[model samples]
Target: MPASSSRLSSYRLPAFALALLLLLGVGIASVWGVSSLRTSNEWIGHTYEVINRIEVAERAIRSTEANARAYRLTGHPEFRSQYLIATHQVDTAHEALASAIRDNPAQHARVKRMREAAQAHLVELRRLFDLQELQGAEAARQATNSTLTLRQWNEFDTAASEMRREELRLLDQRKARSDRSATLLSAIVVLGMLLSGGLMISLMVSVTRENKRARRLELEARGAAHEMALSMAQVGELSKQRHELARYSGLLQSCQTLDEIVQLSIDTIRRLVPDASGRFYLIRASQNFHDSVASFGDHLISSPDSLMPADCWALRRGQAHMVSGEEARQLSCAHLDTGTPAPGITSLCLPLSAQGTSIGLLHVSAATDAMDHGSAVDELIGQLAEQLGLAIANLQLRETLRTQSLRDPLTGLFNRRYLEESLARELQRCERRNLPLSVLMLDVDHFKRFNDTHGHAAGDALLGQVGRQIQAGVRAEDIACRYGGEEFTVVLPELDAAGALVRAEQIRRAVEIATVQHLGQQLGPVTMSIGISTFPGDGLTPEVLLQLADATLYRAKAEGRNRVLHVSYDD
Candidate 1:
């Protein structure tokens, strides 16, 4: 052998030795990888089984709780069926978990102890349920304390905790083996470094760029979450405002009479969202929206006759009709031309409906929409209008019922019931106000003789004529009711003895002057006898006042009728 052949053979022997060492390392690493994989797979299977068992246990607990609530609420036989099903499911869950963990030596050793504790707790719960059914709610509540619930919860929690531990251990082992394999591969790669070193640097740059992008995305996600929270808070505030508006609407609905409804509606609008001035307009039988009723800045417009039909675009549209700038020139009204409401005024008009008919329009004037007034404001206004319309309609119904109950249909004057009610109310008012109230009782003289001579139809017409004359002679605040037969009574509020005498004389004179014409037959002048009595000075009670007035009326009759007489009552 030459020197060169000898040197090459030496190099080959060392290379073969290094290759054999690498092969042995590869074999060891392969065995470790297989062992780690088997351990991970086993942990996965065990974890799945544990999860399945826990799910079953949770299902059983939920079903049991539902059945318990149902049985407590209804106490039905069907609820017993559900309760039994739930208890069976719980037993199955407990048994399945126990059987699955039987092969695990450590688990098996501790399970008996766990099972004993669990069984003890379950028995206590069962006894508690029985006691609750037999005894009372308080005893049951005391039995279902935190201890038993926590113990049952702990059973699953402990098993899940052990499974998590085992799973994590296996994962760690797998990771370690995988890391070793990676390290060996890295070493081999380094041994061949010069060929792929530039590619590794490029890969590292791409990874760094990706990490920066992920951090930016996280910041953006946080910003979006904060914005969403702010929007949700604003929405919550809007919901609160809407609820407050609904309350105001309900308050508007409870008005007892038309006048009361008007006062309440005005007050509600003033108290809530008061920036806008509102007014209600009633359409006449002519189908024209006219400003018959209105309240402005704490003052009510009392001119029932002053209102007339004007072509208002707002009312015609049945929506918000706003006119600003030069366009307002076409609209003619003292409210618009004088600028009392100021310029740039926006008007929202809602149509009032009662019994499916458009009755009128309600107009609201606002300076700005930023007052939280927009379409939502318009809808609220509509609801308010609807409530008002219903209240007015109810008031009308009550008035009709009241008239039917207390008024004489033929004369449109108060009947006997009205006389009684008026007397009671006047007595109460006199007591409260500490004022002297008087009643004047009047009776038509020779009415029956007149009816006998002229006929019953003439007598009824004469009575209607007397009713109108009396209504016109008295103040609007006074109440007039027809007593039985030809007698009538008038409640003279705030009137004392002298005032009552003056009113009684005025009524007598008016009846003497009133002429009744029936079927073109001119009846002679009619006359009435009047009697007056003062309250408190006479008697505090309603019956006493009326009786004293009635006595005085009989005195007027005894004094040859058609005269006024003052009645006296014993104090």
Candidate 2:
């Protein structure tokens, strides 16, 4: 009986030791589970941070590109400042991303590639800026429009996308790891609870508390991830908008004429804002009213063909004026109020100005129910206004310069240089079409004797009067130039010798009867000797025609001062 009691005691000690070991194992397993969950949560957070940094970098890069383009287009100091700010932001974001992804070799390599691409893009932008400063906006615009710049931008975009994709992949992997960790921890707790009740009850309580905390953290992480996705989508949309704006701005800068500007603006505005109808009004040279040079969409039928500056609130105020259905108390532009707008319509009128001078107005309207009345759309409209203003101003300046270069100041006729160019071009056309062209050389009779008798001012007055008479008698297609001094040349396209003779006689008679007044003193009647030369009959080339016509003018002067003479084909 004593031996039996001793054996039972031995079995009791072994059982107690086994129970102790099992408790220790469960405690160690719980600790390991908790640690694993914490590591997983940390990794998930890291992944989110990396993704956020990548997006920030991408946004900064786009901002840099946009502001750089703006600087090149307008050459405004403000755009340069904004560009610098955006470039700094890009550097900051790149550094942060690099730091965050240093632990991942593949991600780090991708970031490196992104940084290189970004640097290349930045260098290209710097080149454009320098070009704008040194060579002018047109030169910079040409550089910006090059395919190399676009390709570099694409490379940067590709690098950014790759980096973003890599981060997203890592996020997925980390999230999966976190899920596995959570599942394993939950399973361990359940098995421990089943193996032993009393010891595991305390462990279960602690683990349950931990599990609740972990689940709360996971929910927060998921919410943050969802929000991040939404932010990324918004960023992408904004990026696309900026890209389109930049591309269109480049195109606008390259436009050479007002007609081209209007056509391009119409197409761009329509494409960018498909839901809206709009009109572009330019202040006419008369400065009295605005002419609607272009209109788009169905709603434009209600718009006027022309409007006074006072008709537009934007023009009158020299700022943007907006009116929505909700703002019934707002005063709409006279131009718009005259038209019947759709119900619940929103309209925006932006004054187009450059260098503090108002040049035009851009009017846009849309039905509120059919479109998004957001700040983004308004911002885009504002940008369009600015771009259009600069383009139009530049075109006007170019045209003014070109006209000054080509026209004679005193007579308002084309100069010798323009005459030569036109004659050459006309000769080419005439040759191509197998048509005849005529050249007339008209000289004021006794221009030096008249000056000596009546003083130089009277001679000038006589010459001016004769030039006016000649211009008034020519057809719309005729090209007239003050050949040099008292000599004038007129090019008549599609005119044979018979037609040329009749035109020359009319010019000579017109000049003969014209009166001249200089400094309130009446001068004698002005007469000019007209000599006519025809292409294919007298000469084929402009130089030959001009020389032969001049010789015929000498013959006219020797024969009779006021009579018109044709080339003597008999010679």
Candidate 3:
């Protein structure tokens, strides 16, 4: 055999040995887990028995007291017998609990106290019985109502409760211990998996190199081609799953509250992978992938764009990307630090797309390279991407829906409904947060005359184009709405009278300078008469704000056709 073949065979022997070692470890761990579970179950059962016995003792005490009272009043031997039987049960219960937790210090103390109290109570009660038997029952009963007997019964009840509480405490402690052990075991298993995977990857790489040295080029080529085919298949499956995951993620993001999003994200990811971490990366249209929305890992990168390899392989080549352990070391890659590429990061990056445009890549890692076993993991990543895509799309759709609901469909500006809702919300926020809010109500200049002259389609196109201009003119925080046909409203939060006036003038200037064209015909520039009002100055309430802004808009229209008017609270 050639030198390469000899080396390859030698490497395979060690690889097989490592595989066997791991198989043995997995078997032993499974057995250990089973034993631990059995022990935990026994502890739980023992604790429950202690609690049950304590309850029985309590019931017996109550029965004994009830029987003694009945025997005193009715002079019935049957009640007396029942009382004696009940009294005997207290001792039996104490014995059961003492036998169950004799080794436990806290449990022993509770059982000791309960047993002593029960013994004392039995002695005192028997004395009372003797007195009633020797003398008259009524005379003995009257004597039995003394503080001594009462105190003894109270002590007995207190001891029983103590026993019950102690048992519960022990149960909690045992459960917590079991939970910790299980968690530790899981961590160990995950660590072991990573170790085994690294060893296997190292062996494979060594064998491949040896084969090449031996000039067994055919075998080497076949092996490389097989790996490439498998990788491609994995990528295809990932692509399909990415679509599905995006839809689910979109649904999760639609919740009105943050708590819902958190819970949904967890559940969604859990379903995607049994024990996997998910990180959501948001980026701008820049090359660096700089912006990150949220991350869920210990060693999350501070900057997204700079962290990506500048070689541009990930973006330029749209392959389901992977970097092997050896390659990582050779390249001195950041991903291989911490004795592992970030947990769950065996490495795969899928590009995010929206409307056929690439947004960013969603990167996933696994505990070990072996977890990249087949196409299953890649497909899972694809599913996650799908959910994320749909989530983002839905959010955008929701925004559009909101715009449609609040805006005039023809004009593409905030609708009357949105105007009303925004006015109310802004008013309340201003009052509670002690911030200024303002509204501008305006009407198109001679809109009816324009419609008649140019036709409704031209007028509609004009409204749509003007709405875009109005949107472009305002800050993102400002909301512009179509109050109605030929009328519009703008709500500015944290703005005063002066600020509102400046914004209003800016909007008027932008509208005057902008012109609309339909079917290659210039329709000339459109303009609007504006009215402005400020919260607590113009009006404090929603209705008052609308009324003032509307009145100012009427005045501006009356004064001329295209002018801005400011309305004060008094005006």
Best of the candidates, TM-score = 2
lDDT of 2 by residue, 1-571 (tens): 2475456545555555655676677688889978988898898898889889988998999999889888877889998999999988988999999999888898888888888889988888888888888999899887665687778778777877887787788778988987887788778777765665654454455556557867988887998899899888767766766777888898887888788888887776665567678888888879899888888787732558899988878888888887777776788778875534445787888999899988988888877643353347678878888989988888889889999999888788899999989999999999999999999999988888899999887877777787788889999999999988999999999999999999999998887777788888777787888888999988889999998999999998888688788887343
Note the clash tally of each candidate. 0, 0, 28
* Backbone clash total, candidate 3: 28
> Can you give the TM-score per candidate against the true fold?
0.52, 0.59, 0.44
lDDT of each: 0.68, 0.82, 0.71
- Tens-digit lDDT track of model 3 for 137-196: 987778785687778777877877777777788899889877876776687677768778
What is the lDDT ranking, best to worst?
2, 3, 1
Lowest lDDT sum, 10 consecutive residues, model 1, at 298-307
**Pairs of residues at least 3 apart in sequence or in different chains that clash in candidate 2:** none
Specify the highest-lDDT model's number: 2
Instruction: List model 1 lDDT by residue over 1-571, tens digit each.
Output: 4475456545554554555555556566556656665665676667567657746765776677677657655667797688778877877876887687776777655455545555555566577668767986466766666776777657755754565466457556756765676666556545434333443444455556656867888897998899999888767655755675677667666767666777777665554446666677776756643655775552221122223334555545554454433345644333333443344555555667677766666656655442344335555656677777777767777888977988887777789887787778878987899888888888999999999999999999988888887887788778887787777889988889998888778878888987888898789798898888888888788888889888988888888899888876322
What value does the lDDT take at residue 204 in candidate 3? 77
Q: 180, model 3: CA deviation in Å?
A: 59
Q: List candidate 3 segments past 4 Å from native.
A: 1-292, 298-323, 326-345, 350-360, 369-403, 513-527, 569-571
